[model samples]
Target: MVSVYKKILFASICIFALSCKSKKEEATKQNTTQQATLVDVIIAGTQQLSNTIEANGNVVANESLEIHPEVSGRLTYLNVPDGASVSAGTILAKINDADLQAQLSKSKSQLSLAEKTEERLRKLLAVNGINQADYDAALNSVNNIKADIQLLKAQIDKTVVKAPFAGVLGLRMVSPGAYITPQTILATLQETNKVKIDFTVPAIYADLIKRGATVSIINNNEPKRTAVIVATETEINTTTRNLKVRALLGGVPINPGAFVKVLIDAGKQINSIVIPTNAIIPDATSKKLIVVKNGKGTFVNVETGLRTSSGVEITKGIAVGDSVVVTGVLFVKPNAPVKIKSVKNLTELTKEQ
Candidate 1:
């Protein structure tokens, strides 16, 4: 009887311990179900997306010309200083004009005498004091003198060099007292108020590049300015398979021959859903986006369009107003319970960064 009671009491203690362990296990499971993984999410929305083509480009002055004399003579007077700003028609240099000046003075004197003779002949002819033939000859002499004076003045004007347009001058290549010819370069002038940017893109974009399209310029990875498309080559370059394009950079001063990067918008604006670039999980086969639905993380295969600094455009598999797990994307798995700690738009997140 003592052995049976001992055995029964031991069995009852074992049963009691088992029941307590079972309750503890159930409570632990409940706690885990309530505690969800915290994550930062953002509601996807439609954004205007533009397709852009990037290419290397160079800067050129809007109007660049080498200053040269129209007529050859000794550079007698040079008032143009190196790198000086000159207005349109500003005299930059002067050639020898002493001979031309002398001829002009002599012609003026002869013209004055011929005019007096013609006036006297006209008065006499009116009163029939001289014949018509003689008066005609006197009038012809006055006209001939006037023509000679005009020719001398023209020759004198050729002895000077003037700025063609308002611009900044480059280094003077010639000095006063140097004999310069029509081919001799005196200096260079550049209109820097606006600049031209020449770039080429693959011929596939020829149809997209049109007049008045806007492009962005970058210098050494920094944004420099914006330019507008002025023109494009009609025929594609056979060797390069590229289309030459020109744009004007207004309100931004860039020197000619500067190398820059050009970004051309090749597509029209389209409303599309976009998400943060970080939100994408690129896989070998397809790209995936972590979308939170019904409090669980779901991986959805997505097709992407244009990728920009702002965000990545979602072409398919995601809609506007869907919440995407931007933060903690790599850590989360499919169907895992998630609790959104905070929500933000992609634009807002970029601003904070």
Candidate 2:
């Protein structure tokens, strides 16, 4: 009986040891499977980045003119229609010049009579039939009459309106036969072959913007054509605390008053790592990023610099050629196992891409 009891105790001990070992093996297998369930990651390299600031602006003509009447009369003939294309010296409108014409005719008749009298006096003076004073009076009358005729002619010419410059005319403000004065507006003309985009930048960036500094302009209405900055205002606006900038657009026909977007480089180039804005993970303690190190996924805190629509500059906590999980970073944890499905090749990770 003693021997049987001893054997039973030995059998129970063996069974207990095997059961504990099985449990330990199962726990180990579960932990390994959990660690292997991490998602894949891809990486990018640091590169020199360019920063840009975007602003809203308006498209304007380089030269704009407001056409106004120079003579007080009824607007008679509008030779140029509304929105008409006109060249320099093109007749735009006409005012009633009957009064001016009548005055001119009277002056011409007086001038002709004065000339005849002067000629007769000259002949008489040469023959000693007239006094020198009388001949001088006749010549003075001719001169006065000629001046009167010239003044009348100038008035008449003022009644006819002509384009000051070659451009497209805006809507006509006065119609035919409308009573007009010198203050009356006839039309507006705008030169549109090369357009200007006007924008204001912050006063802090005034030093960076200079004359001939390159800029880009994007039209909200037409996104295809981009304008280049041609000029900048030398002085800053005191009231607005901003500096004025103008960009020239070539081959794009833009009308005055059209809105546009302006982009200007701050003139500082940096050699920092840039990544898409969405790749940044913001946390309360620090700005973090999911980076792939040693073929495993990890969380790394990073410092950021200038931000743009496409990406943000990584100032620290990331290195060149370090694979970062850009798309699926939200579902990852530090030191987790990951599968790298796609890696951005060196050629694809360059500055432009």
Candidate 3:
């Protein structure tokens, strides 16, 4: 009976030891869970965004060219009524074609003589008084002389420069007596009644704008004027990544080549997740941010777009409902328990200094 009692006493001591050890382990786990890092987080969300981009533009004329002489000669007549409008085919300048006119007159006289000689040869051939070869030679000479006369007349016509279209003329660089060449810029002629605005918009906005769309023109803070898009370049500029666009403003009295500003509105982006720039941690290959899930920090790689005054756009990785740890990015440990002090809206977090 004494041996049985000793066996029961040993069993009770073993059970007591096991219970104490289990309780110590549970207490250690509770202490670890309570010692969580405190952090503030913002719920990731999206907002409606409308983007406006500025463009530098210049006023252009519907038709513009430098009045250049087709041939080199002394100007015998120049009709650049400085800043005056002229109709198409109006004679703007006249080169001294007196020599050409004299040569044409002489050619006409030779033609008359050749024709008379051909007629005489024809009559002789009709009477069988001359060989066929002789009449043929005289007829060939008359035709050659007529061709020479026409050539001289054409040369004389080229000495006069006529306005190609109805346009306002610039100041004359040469006088009536000034000798000019084909390289000389006599004056500038531009049709400014229908002015065009040539500008460049960012290539990202290319899809938002097309031919027949309208752009706003601001000339030195003047009232905004509307210009209808007339043309666009086939491809974007490789260096600047801008698309060249041309817009027309009819009946607007803006001088050609004047500097102007343009505004392009690329419509809204709805429900775009944006985050503070500081929350992003630069990785070697990708950008990353911290997201809180189940009271633990999780690192996520994100794609970005369209950074503006507000914040950077989060294109991928983080969802709309995820809580992003913005305030303690440097202190937050990945996959570690974090005590979220409070959940704030994105706007409230962004407004923090």
Candidate 4:
């Protein structure tokens, strides 16, 4: 009878212990259910956003040429020094033309003699002392001699090289009295008052690019520069399937053949709803944002536009003045109770970071 009474006491102690554990678990679950998620929210507003396309490009001079002589002769005179700025029609160099000069002088003498003979024949023909055919022969001789003089003059002009346009000359390759040929390179000349930024884009963007469209450029370690789209290739490249484009840069100095980053403005400025980039949660087909409304978390679907450095442009879904949850997004679900910890602007949030 004493052993039965001890067994009953042990069972009662076990049941009491299980009841206390169950009560503790029920209290813990109730506490968790009553807790509200804390999130940082931001007010969406309209801002001006530039729509641009980023590309790689190279800089080039507005005009460039590898200057060379048109004829073969010894360089007698190099009037312009190396690396000198010259205007159009400025004498650059002269080739030896002593033989051609001698020929020119002889032709002038012959022309002068033919003129005198023609004058005498005209007077004689008036008196009927010479036939019409004889006078015509004298006149033809005068014209032929004059043509010879003009030919010699053209050959002499070819020996004197002049600058084709206003530009800065590059290094000099030939010296005075150096025998050079038409194939010999004298130097390079480039007009760099402005520059051309050449770049390429995929054929898909062909319709978006047009003449007079503006673009931004940044060279190595240089500030951003603006350029205007001057021209584009009509045909697309088959190998790369890209369209070649050229833009003119003014006010900013750039070297020829310099590698640069190009940003073409594809759209004009317009008011767009922007929000913090962290607030967006991208899914496979769409993006989601946690919007705080009436102290609750609301999931919203949004269509995105231009993406900026600090924020992203929202074209659809959330409207202006809507509070978007930026913090504690991972811990919250739709329609869950939420407490706003702080409301900050997108730019302010960017600055704080």
Model 3 regions lying over 4 Å from their true place: 1-53, 265-353
Kindly state the number of residue pairs that clash in model 2: 3
In candidate 1, residue 320 scores what lDDT?
Answer: 81
TM-score of each: 0.62, 0.63, 0.63, 0.64
Count of steric clashes across candidates, in order: 0, 3, 0, 0
User: Clashing pairs in model 4?
Assistant: none
Candidate 4 segments exceeding 4 Å error? 1-50, 268-353
Quote model 4's TM-score.
0.64
Q: Given candidate 2, what's the lDDT at residue 270? A: 72
Candidate 4, residue 225: the lDDT equals: 76
State in Å the error of residue 16, model 2: 40
Write candidate 1's Cα lDDT for 100-135 as tens digits: 898889888998999999999999999999999999
What lDDT score belongs to each candidate, Candidate 1 first? 0.87, 0.79, 0.86, 0.88
Better of 1 and 3 by TM-score: 3
Worst 10 residues of 4 by lDDT: 27-36
Q: Compose the digit string of candidate 2's lDDT tens values, residues 57-138.
A: 9888978988987889888888757888889999888899988888888888888898999999999999999999999999
Model 3: what TM-score?
0.63
Worst 10 residues of 2 by lDDT: 344-353
lDDT of 4 by residue, 4-39 (tens): 999999999999999999999998877765777988
lDDT of 3 by residue, 271-295 (tens): 6888878889999999999998887
